[model samples]
Structure formats: C-alpha cells, structure tokens
Target: MELSQEEILARLAAISQGTAVEAMKITITEAFKDRVVATMPIEDQHRQIVGYLHGGVSVLLAETVASVASVLNIDIDRQLAFGLEINANHVRPKKDGVVRAIATPLHLGRTTHVWDIKIVDEQERLICVSRCTVAVVEKPAS
Candidate 1:
C-alpha cells in the first residue's frame, strides 16, 4: 500500500504525539519507501552545554527518519517497526538552524531493514551520518 505525502505526515504526526520527536518539532517533508526526509530545528532545548546541536539529538533524528521509513514499507495492520540498532557520526554541529535528515534504505528484508540517514543543516552542510537497523515484528494481539 502506498500513501500520499500528506497522509504520511498525518500518520507520522499521530505517532509523534507527546514524544521527543514532537518536542524537537520534526516535520515529515517527504515519505516513501525509497526515501524519507524530515527536518528539525536547533533550539536551546536541543542544544548541549556548548550550545551546539546535541549529538544525541542528531542520533534521535536519524533513527526517527529511518525507523519511520521502515514502518512505511510494512503492513501497518499486522506489523510494527522498532529500532534494533543505530549508529551515528556527528560530522558537524549546528548552533541555530533547521537540520534535515534524509533516510534511504540500504536493505529491506522480510524481518529487518537497514537505512542510511544523512543529516544536513539548512545551508546543506553535512551534520551527521547514521545507519539504523529496524526489526519488523508482528503486532501483538491487543
């Protein structure tokens, strides 16, 4: 099943309610199996002591985009996606600006998915590079 961009945003917004992603003001700009893109603003709340974008925050944004992309590729009614593992390298820091994270699949398997996420500042400078692995699990009976 395929969803329109607006539909994807609505779904992502629902998932983000009251979560850290919502606090970071993440906006889903593009959503598809081939690629997913999101943006987050660098604010005081997201900064570390040195006043730069927190490395953890970059990893959070990375996982969010990659995990959501994994979810988008699965059967929503029967399966759910969860982060199995993730790693990030913060190449640069942002003091104040919006950072965009683009996630593209490296492997989409029956039970697992791997994504490569590249985060860039508003000026298109690389901020972080991340790889995320997601496990696709059968939804528990509820």
Candidate 2:
C-alpha cells in the first residue's frame, strides 16, 4: 500500500523521536527537497587511537544522513531503502570540533536511490565525503 503524504511525514517524525542515530546526537539542522542536513559535535569518544576523529564515525554519519534523505523521498508504506553501496573519503582529521553532514539525493528510482554525502567541520572545511547507493525493499508485515 502506498502511504499518504501525511503518513510519510508522521513516520519521519516518529523515527526522529527515538532514532538510534540520535545516540550520536546527530541533530537534523535543516531539510528540504532532496536534501537533509545533520550536525554532530566530535568528542574524545569519537576519536581514534591517535586522538583524531574515528574514520568509522565519519562513515556512520554519511550513511545515517543519506539514509534519512532516501527514506523521506521514497514511498513510506511497505517500501524501504537498504544500503547497497557506500564509499567514503576523509579529507581532514579532527579531534574536537562540530561536524555537519549534508546529504543530497543524487538519484531516486523505484528500486534504488543514490545519495551524495558531505561532512564539514566548524571551520566549514570538508572533512569527509561519500556516495551511497540504497536498495529499496519491501517492508515486512508486522
């Protein structure tokens, strides 16, 4: 069954309420057509052995932000997108700073979605970038 626009919006709001991604304190700063923005403060727990922010954290941010956008763009009833392919490139290292990730829909098709994800620091320097492909699948009956 295809979801109404209001249903989709309600689902998004419900997911935002207790999202596991929220554990990272990833705040949605802005959202618009085909795009969404999320921000996080990099702390020691997110750092690597060398005191630089963990590379995995960057990847996680990219995936989370991209997933959020793709989810909102798709049919919200039974269909859902699962990560198919994701590639990340880290440009700079940081230990303590505010990091923001912006995800934009590159392509949204019936079976798949592609997103371009970018992360920037407090100084507005690009810290990480990624391209993600999510496979749209049917949600199982409850």
Best by lDDT: 1
lDDT of 2 at 127: 95
Q: Estimate each model's TM-score.
A: 0.95, 0.85
On TM-score, the candidate that comes out on top is 1
What range of 10 consecutive residues in model 1 has the weakest lDDT sum? 1-10
Model 2 lDDT vs. the true structure? 0.82
Model 1 segments more than 4 A misplaced: none
Write out the backbone clash pairs for model 2.
none
> Which RMSD values do the candidates have, in order?
1.2, 3.5
Residue-by-residue lDDT tens digits, candidate 2, 1-142: 6666556555655676776566666777665558888888887767899899899888888988788787777766888878899999999888897999999988888888899999999878999999999888989999
Candidate 1 C-alpha lDDT tens digits along 36-64: 99999888999999899999999999999
To one decimal, what is the Cα RMSD in angstroms of model 1 from the true structure? 1.2
